[model samples]
Target: MNSSWFRKLLLSYLPVFFVVVTILFFVFFQSLNEQNRKEAIKANEFLTQQIVLFTDNSLKTLNYQVLRDTLTADELRFFFGSDNDDVYRNIQATELMDDWKMNNPIIDSVYIIRLKDNFVLGDGSGQAADFVDQPFIQTYINQKVTAGKWTGKRSFRPYAVEKPTDVITLVQGFPHFSTDKSGYIVVNVSLSKLKKSISPMYNPKLTYVRVTDEQGATLMSDSGADGENSVLSHYISPYTGWAVDSGPTGWGLAHVALHFYNIWVIIALVAVLLGVFWVVHVTRRNYKPISQLVSLIRTSALINPYKGQSGNNEFGFIQGALEQLLEETSKSMQQNQEAIILRKKHRFQEAVEGIVSIRESEWMADLLALQVNPVGAHAFVLAIEIDRYHQFIETYHRQDQSILKFVVSSVTGEMSGLRDATTWAEWITDRRLSAIIWVPDDADGEVLSGQIGEQIVQWVQSNLSFTVTIGVHGIASNLEEIRRSHEIAGNLLQYKAVLGTGRLLRPAQLEGSEQRVHDYFGTIHGLSQSIRIADGAWQKHIEDLFSQMQDSISSRKEIESFLQFLHQQLNRVFLELSKDYRSVWKDSGAELLELGRSWETLDELKQGCLRVFEEMASKLQALKDSQRTRAVISDIRTFIEENYHNPELSLDYLSDQFMIHAKNISKLFKEAYGYNFVDFLIGLRMDKAKQQLLTTERSLQEISTEVGYFNYNSFNRAFKNVAGVSPSDYRKQQTS
Candidate 1:
């Protein structure tokens, strides 16, 4: 009866125990899964940002290359210039483009359009007009673009292939990479090759990355896990305006991490089940016999017979449970301790972002628990960023990048630690890190100067391949001001474009900059008038524009705004001009305007702008010269036509008749009609000779006399030179 009752009780509770254990495991696994998913999303966001950075760097490199070749490559000079009729040069130029495309797989094709003739050239020969992306090229040709920014993805069919290819194109105009009517160099980047170039940054098996274009269309996506779940993170790039969607193509550590949690829960459940079975066995043994009861009680945690207490078994049970609890607690604490640094970083990041309200004491207590809070002090934030981040990224591998970031955080923390303050630093971004220092309110002014930031920069420059720039805000007197301090520090980093990178920037440097006023309208008007007349002062106007920016602008946006204003003024000046002059700016002046778009400093801007402005002035001068010579050449042509029968008629005769120099007439004549005085006169005589030869049945001598050549032999020679036959034979062929 007792055995049957014991079995009944065990069976009744076993189902409930299993149900409860299963529910607990399910909840634990669900939480683990959610955390893993969130981590995957964050990882994917980072991957997308890296892709944008890489692509932008590559584009800048290509732009510089195109500019260099167009200006300095001797092989392409004839092809892009007026000597394009040289078929060998056409071949050489085409070969050079082929080399560019071959050297970089990212460039699927390189095409050039001579704006003068609408003549196009690309790889392997065929410039397919109907279906080869000529419509897009035609659109840009019709509309004058001030500068070339990277275009979004489009179907670029370089040849008349059966299928169209997806490409992101870079349109750089020749004469200057930015503007002008010379020609355009359009580079089509293959999405597949772009992915291949970027593939080195990640493990393909673990995750997949998709890069979109400016239009939010997918340009290329690496082959990753083929499912929606494979894409765990999606973000739009601020720089390129492209979207990057990333997901686990297969189970990565983050994706399979929940399974580990599930396994742990299962192990724990198994232990609990073993404990239940041991208890059942102990009870079953106790029922074996009264003789075996004491031995069973001694071996089990059921009772302590030596104590002889009624509740001894309860004490033993509590002792055994406590022992198990202490062991598990020790393991749990180890796990928690491993996460301390992560939690500290998380807490600090939250405070800096204002994601958590810090006016309350709760934040302070949390910081204290994390062991990062100062007892009594004011605080400020320092923003340190890698200078020339594009170069930095290109120079280092993924692991080296992490190591450099660690070095940054460590040096920042250690440097600030030497002072009378508590400091903590963490990577706030891939290329930037932040440090928060709690110092005494009476801290010296050096807090903003030759102290921590200077030392950090010196060390990084000395030891690392790259240098860093640092920016700081005023000390935060209150808890709520910490986020503002951080934000101000971040803003100060922008001055690297002005003040130069690799230095410590303070709030004092920004003082009085915002209050300065600029008068651009007066100078802009002068520049326009000067450019219109091919005056040298237009070059000086460019300098003045840059000087205005340097003097009045303190921020990047302000500089860009001033440049945009200057561009509009120039545009307005030229738009009002005639088409002949308008073409000068539309074809060539835009390139000069483009010079200002990507400069790092006012000096760079001044030099590039000056260079292009000088070119624009030169072009305007040449155009004015052409206009002056046009009327003289016109009169010269009329006199030649009227005096063709005068055998002594020559360049000197025409120069005397038109009152221009003989050499000038020859030069202007060739410039206008692509023939010199002698050849042109010979052509007019030859036409009259051919008409008379075929219709009038005139003798060769009389025909030669009637033409400019008084000598019959000279007339026959000139006639043959022009008509490829003797005058008598040419006449007979037509007469027959």
Candidate 2:
């Protein structure tokens, strides 16, 4: 009967005891349910995985076997493409199909349809019109193209009396992978036998399993107790594109737990009620000390930013600060998400750029995660560049620029998707977006890419203020091919200098000129020769060089490279000129060299370089004609007079010795001394021979040999022709 406050508080512990006991019971049941579910999932997934792997292995083996025979086997190839059907070869082909059936139980029938004359060949059925699968064969023959891979499940009846058996077919074009409609080779795989190989016997009461195609349509469904309502796990068959779903019977662990433990539900409700009362008792006792501290903090001005926030009595300032922190945290999280997206784009860029290499499986996973299509049998890469990029920059702010680029890529993606082509696109620069597109092997990926390019150009022109140029690379078949595609497509944008903008540019349009590779060394040599002599042909050579550049459709960078090379060579030629003859070229050439790099097109480059060349040629010719000529000719005359005694001394020898051209020396000789190279050499040699005859008494051969003639007869004729007398006769008269 003692009424103490401690006794009342001790009595409140009774409900807390029951609450703790009930929680333990609930946790035990929850753990058991979770454990059972995990076990079921693991077991089912394992079995489903076995089905997928086995099916893939078997089908892949058969596919490769037939593909190999089609490509390598003579009998099979002859049966498909041979105009004259040899009976022995037909039997050999039948034997091959029979071997396929004996080794693999999955092969139901194998046949060849020669599209040329509606002829069919199969097991025991020669090239006859009475073939049972004529209608089926004609369908593929009429389509004129066959799939290289196995097709989805379809019903096939080999004989008239038999019901349709579900089969997956493999249809290959004649010559294995070619696109010719000349013939087709079809292999029918029995779905029943394939499933039998995966699992000979599967129970229906305990679980449900279904295999579905890419369209989510059911291709094969097991006799299951629960149907699809209790699907626990799903696996995709990489070979057949069918989904493998497995699950237990209805209600699984839940039904058992619910029915057997109905009493626990009532007990749990009672425990919750007890928990509520216990919390109330504990909170009242705990609130007195904590509330006093909160009251003191509430009076502070930390949360007084707004009336609504500051009005709360206890813990209001703390809640306001927490609210602001949470808001900031959310904003930071959004930034982090954006960073994640940017990282994904960066990774893609690296892959296409071949900066970072990844395995095929990992790259495929990344593409799937990005919602980008995986590589297909036929793929293409496209580069879309904004027209007049400088104008584009001035027309929009940075944010607007990003938005416009995003629209470009997004529109391309949508257009390609509508065409049933798989596409991935991203902006790789401020004004350029790149995309990789893939279509079914049977579809025309190059044509699709062209159509998509045209649509993008038209759409942008209609909706936006700017248009774009699209450069499409040729077809690609694999990941490595895609990297190559990226390089070509990205490089194609430089062709815009010649192809122009606001249109679709295809490989066909640009491929012809890309092969028109012209070597510039020859033109460079000719230009150098003309400049050395300062001939009028310098302008003609310049025109020829630029015309080749135009015909080749060289890019702006290529043109710049050529011009820079031209400048370097011409500058070397200019430095050799006399100072008084061409002092202004040293300064004017620098200004012209700078101007050379600013050309936007071949025509501009051609015209600009032509003007520079005209000035240069004029100055060079003037310099060559003035004091420079006098100085060079004087040196030439002195060298010939001293070297006339040497047998090899002549115009070519003097030209090499002086580092000048023979033709230039000949022209200068006639200009300076009023005689040709041969005439001057003869007159000098005849004078020396007469002096030798008068003083040394040398023979005619010795005198001719001493005067730069390897052949004596040539020197005798020249001496006689130049001095109007034979060298011997002239020497005798001068001596007497």
Candidate 3:
């Protein structure tokens, strides 16, 4: 009864266990099949590699033949003399050997190895006769007679075949041009060297590689097998009628299976169990720190004043502490913000009192007390108000407010150099900035003001396409009365006068001499000035005024003040000129006056003055004759030669240096030099080229570059034009 019951239980479990075991067996068998197929491909790949190796050897011999033929036909015939000429042969070989090695370093020796003549010339081991009748040498000679070319691989007859042995010889035949091709110019290469050259063809990592000759003899094997039916026996060399075969051996497959089967099965089973345990453990523990950190971060994210302090445990103790610290920090920050607001308000009041409070600056009072409080010294104030800051904010979005503030702060830092002398700047209001710069007591405040204005204009124009106006006040000795100066500057900036729009202006330039003003003012003053003026007298007067202003201004404030003064005076003059000759200054006249009224305050008025000067300069440019323009062009050409090393110096810079229009200079240069300005520059550069070629032994390429021609072809063409010869020809003539 017991035996029957046991058999029944076994029968019941047999189907389920058999099904599972069968599935496992099928998977295992599939893996083995794939592995076997991969091994077969690896073997085929090895055979292909051996074929490639033989092909490379063959190709090398062919190349040798071609190179020998070229040398015999070209160098040996024309420049190297007859084959019998030893001196010529030695010199030729010395010159050409290095070049030959560059292409095929496996070529053991290159020489004229003769058969009937029995003469050899090169650095090789044996006599010429020893190799004269060798199979490869003879075959190449025979083939050359009919096929016009010969090359192959053959073993040296007497050489031994052993480990680390010289295996084969590569020979090629070349005919001497001196005779009717009696003998050969030969190249002999060692097969051992050739083997090394193509060793990469047989990879030991993926497959075994073997080489076999036509006679079914195994010639070589990466496995170093010497037995019958070795790896080489199955290989077929693709070149030279040889065979190669490669594949995983039975022993290797067995080893791989045994090695991997034991290792991977254990590792996989263990890894699955460990991974499941680790996941469970980690999932349970991961939330504690995260929960604690979340609470801490939430505390800091908002303004929380009573967050708890952290504990000493590792689970986010510091995070809790940080939350508590953040709460305290928020309270402190609120107090500081309120304090800062009060301080700024107080500073604003002081600034209004002419104490020149520099906003966001803790050190302004110290700088001003030290630099501006000296008796008899002058202080110039300039207000820089950005136009359409709100528009910028709206266009860029509120996120850009911090960025703009950073930009303003950076600009303020750059301008802080003036603060070395007790000059300081402050942000008075949003988008509005002010600067108070002290000048020497005896200095002309207008000059300083103009400088400040010009610098502001240049900074705005050059760094960003923004507009700002600077207003300057008259010099003030008494610090107590500086408020009047500040007010005067502010009032001048407010004036809607014809002055530079983004510039500096002073009180003196705003008022000016009444008599000289009327010269541009009254109708009679225009008449007297028009026809009676000397050739450049009026221009000189204007230039002199600017030059004097440039000389006197030492601070940005003074420059703005100076610019303001010049603007107002020039505006009055321009208004008078417009009234006198309404026909001459039509739109330009009205444009100047309109530009003047756009000034927001006395600061903007200074900017308007510079605008008037620029416009007037443009108008006077129309009066310049072509001859005078040509002279100016000549002056510029001289400047280029003197400043060639200055990389920043360019045609544009030249125009700026002369304060003339670049286009005008270009036109005048074309008229005077009979070529485009750039072309003339090329001519000048050509002269430099000729000098470099004749005076120094620099390479033609270097000479070409030194004179600024990036390419040799263009330099050659230009050099021929200017020097009447090519660079090489010029160099030869100079040497002679």
- Report RMSD for candidate 1: 33.0
Q: What TM-score would you give candidate 2 relative to the actual structure?
A: 0.39
Off by over 4 Å in 3: 1-207, 210-248, 251-314, 317-322, 325-332, 335-426, 429-486, 489-515, 518-736
Superposed by TM-score, candidate 2 places the C-alpha of residue 278 at a distance from the truth, in angstroms, of: 55
Compute each candidate's TM-score over C-alphas.
Answer: 0.48, 0.39, 0.29
Candidate 3: 10-residue stretch with minimal lDDT: 519-528
Better of 1 and 3 by lDDT: 1
Clashing pairs in 2: none
Write down the worst ten-residue block by lDDT for model 2: 301-310
Candidate 1: Cα lDDT at 727? 86
Q: Best by TM-score, which number? A: 1
Per-residue lDDT of model 1, residues 1-736, tens digit only: 3888678667756755765676577667667676876776777788877887887777778767777887788776778775446788888888888878766668877788777766787742444354366778777777655446778877776566546777778776666644456777788888777777889988877777877666656677766546565666677766667777877665657556634666666766776777577567765665556445545545765433334334434334556556666766898998888788678778878888888667658777877787776734677788998876776777889898888788788888778777767777888788789887877656763454358778889999899888898998756766678789899999988776677778898877766664344456677677778877887788787777656656654577776666677677778878888888888788655775566455655676667767777787888898887787897788888888998999879877776777888988888788899989888888898999899988896788888888877789888777778889998898778988
- Top lDDT prediction, candidate number: 2
Error of 3 at 410 (Å): 18
- Candidate numbers sorted by lDDT from highest down: 2, 1, 3
